[model samples]
Target chain A: MPNQEKIRVNQLTKVFLKHKERVMALEDINLSIKDGEFICILGPSGCGKTTLLRILAGLEKSSSGEHQINNSGTDRPLQSMVFQEQGVIPWMTVEENVSLGLRMRHAPKKLINERTKTYLRKVGLTPYAKLYPKELSGGMKQRVSIARAFANDPEILLMDEPFAALDEQNKFILQEELLSIWEETKKTVIFITHSIDEAILLSDRIFLMSSQPGTIKEEVKIDLPRPRQMTQVRSDPNTAEIFLKIWKHLQTEVQESRTKNER
Target chain B: MEELKKAVEVEKEDLRRRQRSKKFKQILTISSPLFMLVIWEFLSQTAIIDPRFFPPPTTILQTLFSMSASGELFEHVRISLIRILFGFLLGVIPAITLGLIMGMYSSVRHFFSPLIMALMPIPTLAMLPIILIIFGIGEFSKMVTIAASVFFPVVINTVAGVMNIDKVYSDVAKNYGANPKDFFMKIALPGAMPVMMEGIQMGQAIALLTIVAAEMIGANSGIGYVIWMNYKAFLIAEMFVGLILISFFGYLFSLLLRGLQSKLIPWK
Candidate 1:
């Protein structure tokens, strides 16, 4: 059998009309993902990284070109999104928020309950399941968000800067938690981030994007071993070389965007 | 260990002081109205202010008691409350549903925005004449006028509430496999609740105001009508009794609203 892709985007472009001004958010963005492959799209702020993810998530439409996801698993949800802010939904209790995706899809009572309980425990939010998002701290809220996404059992998980707002300790803890969860299910994950280290730590491959009319500039494969730790990235001689390469590519793009903005 | 104990003692002392201060504030709040009533009583007894207009608190209390005994106060309050209940529900239910729909769909908003904007500025009392002309001096007119008054504040506030909900929430709903019904129920309704509560409270306040004005102008059997009749007859104490009853009910309803708000939007 031919190696058919799980998700394929062909010349996908998005133009946002703001204040009657044409703003090209993404220009000819094309990418493909295999099933269960963790991919990260790295870019600076306002680089349409979020726009690209939104299109893939079906929350926004591309202006030109087609984006398609071939879901062989008919019952599983096509995609589930983890947003950077208020993702767990403040109005819902942790358990309710965690079960949102499943509930939305009309999943049965027993499966919803079992999955919610399991995921909440996996995210260390079992004690907080009955609490509202407002009552929980930032880290705990994100844990609920993460748990909700995983519990849905979607074919693909699209996370947009899920840890960008957290403090270092919370970010690292959640990142480790995310890795643990992802390792088990290994659902195709597309994570968008500005942090180079986050991309290196989480993704099997990094798609480096440039700012002006956001497009993929480079794709660097990360052959880092599974069961990875943050400390391991520091010691691995290969990681430094990869980090420098990504940094150089991103640094130049950022500088170029800054210069254009000044003009 | 000694330092830790000292720290604990300090914290306890601080908490006690805070509790004491909070108690003092509550006492002050309760006593301020009574203090004013006492002063008013003293002044009225001395005939400092005309007893004809500013009757003594004791006389007003007697008026209240006599009205209660005669069952006139109960009849008036009951009729007015019935009007308010009907009018409030008539305005609020549709207003909220349409407001949420408007918030979700801009085309619906566009169609209604001009109509609401044009209608909102005209006072409910101003429409009373037209309402009277159409429905005549009946229960329907008073209720309709009150409903008009109750409608705008709730609809506008609810729309604002729904519109101001974080965009990310709806996006999250769409990204997941949430159907349209799920979006409406799970996302929009609960998300708009805190602001919608504001609209409902304002609706209640206006409903009270409109019902009073409406009863005084058009109806024959309500608290407002009784107050107006007492004014015509120069029964100053009875009018004061009516005013005091309105104040009491207003305070009670506000407390009820606070309880509902806390129950529904505990996260807020």
Candidate 2:
């Protein structure tokens, strides 16, 4: 039997030394993520959602905290991160970029090829396997990056607003695809985004954060059904109600952050 | 509209014909020097430009053939090539390594930048006399001079190559759990290859030029030595042959480097 708890974070804090001043980026961040859950960290820019995600991904060190991943001894849960800028290597072809994590892990060439091809097909990028990042559109590049993260078959997937650069239509389609892929893989996902609609649409739970020395202000459970359609979700009264509640909390933080930034 | 369509068709046909003609012209252009040789032979036979001083192309070819048969031309070419190879390797390897280090670490680059700036302005050829005096006009002196000629451009271009890489690539590598070796091999090396290859190309050309000049000053057996000896003996034909050989070797060397570059970095 799998452990119910996937990731546990206890009193995590991050402090940044900017010049001579010690600035806290995140303070007293504590959260427990259940297995196979989709969680979104929502906050304004500089609210330390990204900092929290980075710490979780082991890319950045926390000032003080404890984090543990429950793998049940089957394997160390693989973690993969997707960035906003679409971290596809410009020199590599789409397929090559998709297989990079596997290659890094020293996976056999045949397995890498098979997994890369499968993921490319899933992302609707099979035809673009030979195409370099420079040849792809913004949406296509993001798809490639997502496919790469998926190809790793990670236990936890961290995304820092991966689709924030895409147009609405592309974003909707990608969101649907992401949900479908997540349903099949059941990976624990920690997505950070500034979009309220995105958080409401995708997350099983939204961890709304407050600005400056960021701390989780509230956690909103999403009781919507599976295989959610964006159109239906938008039209559904419950979705709109949840979005409005999140927005009301976010608006004040946004205004305060803007004023602070200006100063 | 009909006329315009017809004109378009005609223009396309003309373009196709022009492309074919241009290809043929390029082939002819490459062989033009050889054709000039034929013309020169005929002109010399018909008594033009004093056959003694400006030898006919045939005479030069014959001299080249005789020299090769006697192993004289081969010896000179071998010596010159060995000198260039040694000098280039000595200069370029250290330059690239130092350049990469300096580029990756800004503090190191800052410390060395002023030193490089001061040293770069001194021409490689100007140090020839000092080098000869120190090293005693031997093969070492010639090799060291050639190495010096190749070093600066390689170092400068290598630093530029490393510095110009996109920061996003490095960030991506870091985010993906890449260690230092993986980051350098996968991102930094490939990213900077194009500029580094160009630097190597420049270094190669400089190496060849410096080697020849160094040979002229002190070497006992090289193309430059041949040229100098021929000139002193008033053997203008032999001197011209040496000049042609130098050009041919330089051209071949460049083509070789370009081919290697294309093969190594097909994407660039």
TM-score of chain B of each: 0.97, 0.86
Model 1 lDDT per residue over A1-263, tens place: 02458889999989999999999999998889988889999998999999898888888888999988888758888888899967778889999999999999899999999999999999988888888888988888888888899999988899999998899998988888899999999788899999989999999999999997899999999998998899898799999999999989989998999899899
Q: Could you give me the TM-score of model 1 versus the true structure?
A: 0.96
Stretches of candidate 2 exceeding 4 Å from the true structure: A1-3, A261-263, B1-71, B97-141, B234-241
Q: Which residues of candidate 1, in runs, are more than 4 Å off?
A: A1-4, A18-21
How good is model 2 by TM-score? 0.81
Q: Model 1: which residue pairs collide? A: none
> Alpha-carbon error at B35 in model 1, in Å?
1.3
- What is the lDDT of every predicted structure here? 0.90, 0.86
Alpha-carbon shift of residue A239 in model 1 (angstroms)? 0.8
lDDT of 2 by residue, A1-263 (tens): 23499889999999999899988899999999998899999997889998898787777899998887677565433588888865778878888889878777777899899999999999999998997788889999999989988888777899999988899999999999999999988889999999988988899999999999799999999988988989888888988889889999999888888898799
How would you encode candidate 2's per-residue C-alpha lDDT over B48-141 as one tens digit per residue?
6678777888788888887789888898999899888899898988888888877778999999999989988998888888988898877888
